[model samples]
Target: MKTNFNKEWKKDRIGSAHSGENPMVIAKMRSGFAAIGDTQFLPGYCVLLPSKAFGSLEELDFKQRSEYLLDMSLIGEAILKVCNPRRVNYSIYGNTDAYLHAHVFPRYNWEPEERIPYPVWQYSGEKWRNFEYQYSDKDHGKMKEKLSNKIYELMEKAY
Candidate 1:
């Protein structure tokens, strides 16, 4: 069964036996990073999508899953390196999107407002950064460039 993650990716690359989207256009293991939306509100908001679809991490082959986590770690490193927020948050719940993607978010301790574990749905005077907007196009591209370059550098050195 085709999943949501790969679908959007399909609009972008499909792999061989691999089920990743836009495998060609998408950044390689070491090419760069891709920002989902342009909202600059959150500096390092990225989704390290799996090359293929499996309901959960439990389904992926041990080696492939390990490598993906490593990649995610490298991606996370670049994210924190660039954003430098108070701390970082990683979310891998595939409930809504139903795609194999991980959320790499930079959490700040001194944020203007209080943000809880689950994002509040009501927009009522809520700061959009936590709920909606995060990265803006003008700055996001440049930031993505930095993060992407870092990933590429790490990828080159290792794999």
Candidate 2:
């Protein structure tokens, strides 16, 4: 499927995923969609978007919650394999988006010594908006392909 680089998917991430309009989507997992992040400032960053929209994790029943959490971790593992960062960090904060999407960050040891200890959010706004850090198929396509394949491989092994 073609990746829609335009901002059309911003207004409706989950809906766009359902319609296959979100360019960031890497794979459709059992519980949600595994998508590359909008910014590549931290390469291999990703988000786990639920197939069905919900305000928070608690909105799901026990089994569904388990699947979602497992999917999140699996993506983290995939990131570890593909990105080869020092480690992976998983975060689910509905504060800004108010949706049940989890962030899978591949933390690297090469990051600035001062910022390495802080959360990805602690980065400057300029880093987030810098064109160099933005996600593009040209710069990130190969890695995304590897990550997508690894996610599928891990999923198969997982189940």
Candidate 3:
């Protein structure tokens, strides 16, 4: 099975998703593509990238907006089934990426107590840079496949 896509996938995420080159992609939904995140600091972390890049959610029409939100939550549901995290947190901020995308983070009970009630960003920067948390074929392939398969199943039920 495919592991994580190459780093170059970031240069054209939406395009890569469309071309079927983004190995990180879990599934393509009505409004966008759901993909595994670069870092697996949170095992089930994923992102929803619109089929076409838009600067913000406001750029999308009402139907597109609703579809995007629905697709994002569908990804969260797949994460819930695959990773079994305590809960999932969804966030949309295009500040860094400069495009419309939603992050789906699965919050786990096993996380440090101090950070449990806080956002995932509360984790030290080291958490983001640490190699152990980085995605690798040996480390994350199985879970990614599980997530992809579950998402396909859920999407089938959803649409």
Candidate 4:
């Protein structure tokens, strides 16, 4: 499906970060923006969105592509430092959204035994759509702070 970037993301999220309207943004990286995920089913889930919208990774120049991927890793590392999940799952599929972005999902040891050994996609639709897992400033304040701090620290070390 074709996505309306202006209507879906840039209008509500992308520029919101620059204008201080979106609190989910953790840090602005070399080639993109790092932000916490809308859902917290896995707690430390996050996303890496490119600074400039692209249809896919192949659309970016080599350097920008590398930087974007590196930024994704930085986000995973920051999550590892803060949440210490069992493993981090990285995915860059644009099938639904049609934008070049990466998802960083931290898998925990405490997850259901059956789900632990498989990709997060194995989880039910209810798990993904549950309002109970929605991000809230009140509930996720500490996590947001720690993740933001760690991301900044990692970014500084890279410079």
RMSD of each: 6.5, 2.1, 2.1, 4.7
- lDDT score at residue 90, model 1, on the 0-100 scale: 72
Which stretches of model 1 miss by more than 4 angstroms?
Answer: 1-26, 30-40, 116-136
Range of the 10 consecutive residues with the lowest summed lDDT in candidate 3: 1-10
Model 4: residues >4 Å from true position, as ranges?
Answer: 1-12
Over 27-69, each residue of candidate 1 has an lDDT whose tens digit, in order, gives 5662223334323345666666666556678778788778777
Candidate 1 structure, TM-score to reference: 0.68
**What TM-score quantifies how close candidate 2 is to the native fold?**
0.95
- When 2 and 4 are scored with TM-score, the better candidate is 2
Instruction: In model 3, state the lDDT of residue 159.
Output: 80
- Candidate 4 lDDT, 19-132, residue by residue in tens: 666667888889878988877899989989788668999999998888888889989999999999988999999898777889999999899898888888789988877777
lDDT of 4 at 91: 95
Best model number under lDDT? 2
- Each model's lDDT comes to 0.57, 0.90, 0.88, 0.83
- The residue pairs that clash in candidate 3, if any, are none
Q: lDDT score of model 1?
A: 0.57
Cα lDDT tens digits for candidate 3, 1-159: 224344676689999899987877878899989998878889989999998999999999999999899899989998999999999999999888899999999999889899999989779988887777877768888898998898888888888
**Candidates 1 and 2: which is better by TM-score?**
2
Model 4, residue pairs in steric clash: none
TM-score of each: 0.68, 0.95, 0.93, 0.89
Better of 1 and 4 by lDDT: 4
